[model samples]
Target: MNDSAAPVPIVPVILCGGSGTRLWPRSRKTRPKPFLPLVGESTLFEATLARCDAAAGFAPPVVVTGAAHLDLVEAQLNGCKGAGTIVEPEGKNTAAAIALAALRLPADAIMLVCPSDHYIADVDTFRETARKAADLAARGWLVTFGITPTGPETGFGYIRRGEAIGVASGWRVDRFVEKPDRARAQAFLDDGGYFWNGGLFAFRAGTFLEELAAHRPALAETVARAVRAGHAEGGRFHPDAQAFAAIQSESVDYAVMENTAKAAVVPASMGWSDIGNWQALHEALEKDGSGNSIAGRAELRDCSNVLVQSDGPRVSVIGASNLIVVVDGDEVLVCTPEGAQDVGKLSGASRQ
Candidate 1:
């Protein structure tokens, strides 16, 4: 990147879609994971907003969320001045959500598409990295933040680095790997050429829309129509319900990046985590020498890497490792680390 190049205007596009079923009892459809204080005192959604503040040379953020969660969205965005919310009639996955925000902003605006519920420990590094991504996006490349892998994590997709582009370790994407088996993930870690697909993205609105129209013509047109028929009041913009519902669900990765010749990746090691499940959340919180972290009421003896969380009742654990115990309302969850991945499949996770 040319240090002398002028900076482009960046508008953060926050996608708040999933109900976060993996978090189970604590996360519900009405009160999703993004709104919950999973990582720290402030909710994840709030942290996301602060990370891309206009003070950091960003324009007001455009948040795309479902209508059912409007109250939570409004509540969290209360103190954020100039932030705009694009209300979707229903959840349509990342592609449509991003398209909605892209179409709503000025064509030249650089849209920083960020998931509302991810955790980043180092805010400064994230801001700096985001700026770098913006620089790439302004140059007509679709950019994604490539998180330095801490381990052979099977939960995330991986991006293979191609030839270097721009400056400071940016790469033309060679290929995207789906969540691989343990052996493949280990091989990727050993190769030292793959980065976890962190889901953060950057691109010019016009460029993204053009690519989406070319690759996902039908979805692109319907989203454009939804935006055209949409109405805005104050900070909230509501897309046409019928039009939005008519659009087929798709993710931005499949709809554009995978097919576009402009794909690029930026490597970053800024202490990021999805905080996706109890086990993952346990890793983020402060832990004792025994490798145990407790919230609310809990007790552990001879335990290693055990997470105990309760909304009310006290719990006790002895002689256990890699265990998760959670109590929320009428539901209580107990499982091993491996079992954590399937928490979303439980009957309680789907309850409204």
Candidate 2:
């Protein structure tokens, strides 16, 4: 479908709620990885704004984030060319979060929902894939981007592909597979019919709500109230928090996509990374001969395949291998790379 002939209004929804507990000390409740200047001078949020494809009818993205980060979210987007910002009263997960945006957008518009904290080095490929997804979405199909898995990654969920909808095109979601263990992940790599679930989705507004209402009525009803109550000004919506909180917390995957039959995955390689934890960050960052990555200000000696960051005085690491070290004002995090996923649990325990 020529986008010019029959244009699809694409609205970008940026989900920016995760605590970044795995990267704690630097990524905190008040400031998460999305807000932190990780990759460069610009925060991840700003990079996401820069990545929007306005020519493809993608309007300024609507950022779905917690109220606490409202100030940060607005600040990052303030100078951005084409981006909108909205805050949720609480973290109600993706289903309610997305519903709020869909309700506020034009009924005829299609949306491309993205997470704010991810890192994509190849912006061109990302934008191109998004445009393709938008084309599919315009055709009344709920489209999702499926990352071509490079290796056995236990960190991400997997999607099984079905009969093709086009040549190198739409694929029916065989099922939403859970994050597998190392053995299962390796098998998925060897089997060759699986792709990493990137979480990016494109679909029509009314169609999504229709499916949500039919499959997950409770969630649909609750989100509907919030979406209806939401007020939009220049494409930004301020939903009623009290009402939104009434909705149960759930991910879009669970509330709709998993249940709906129209779900399709657009298999593409966009160099995607959720950056959920330090290990993921380490994997995504550029590495040196010693296999060590340094962010902020740090010095490493005899380190291999390790990540270290310092926000204070010049830091030094010696004889550390496959570890993560982060130093912030009052917090210091050091852990083995394999155990980095447990950092969230450790941080939660420390709070107690």
Q: Which candidate wins on lDDT? A: 1
What TM value does model 1 have? 0.97
lDDT, candidates in the order shown: 0.90, 0.81
Question: 102, model 2: CA deviation in Å?
Answer: 0.7
What lDDT is reached at residue 83 by model 2?
69
lDDT tens per residue, model 1, 1-352: 2344456788999998788999988999889889999877999999999898878888888899988888898899976878889999998889999999988888889999999999999999999899888888888889999999999999999999999884544889999999998899999999999999999999989999999999999999999999899899888999999988899999999999999999999988999999888888988888999889999888888999999999999999999999999999889999998999999999888774
Tell me the lDDT of candidate 1: 0.90
Over 4 Å off in model 1, which ranges? 1-5
Deviation of model 1 at 170, angstroms? 0.6
Residue pairs with colliding backbones in model 2 are 291-305
lDDT of 2 by residue, 1-352 (tens): 2233266667888888877777776787778889987776788888887788565446867788877888788887876566666778788889888887787777668898988888888888888888777777776777889999999998899999888876536788888899999999999999989999988999888778888898889888887787677676673567777788788888899989898888888877877888878888888888999889887788888879888888886778888888888878767777888788888888442462
How many pairs collide in each candidate, listed in order? 0, 1
Index of the highest-TM-score prediction? 1
At residue 1, what lDDT does model 2 achieve?
A: 28
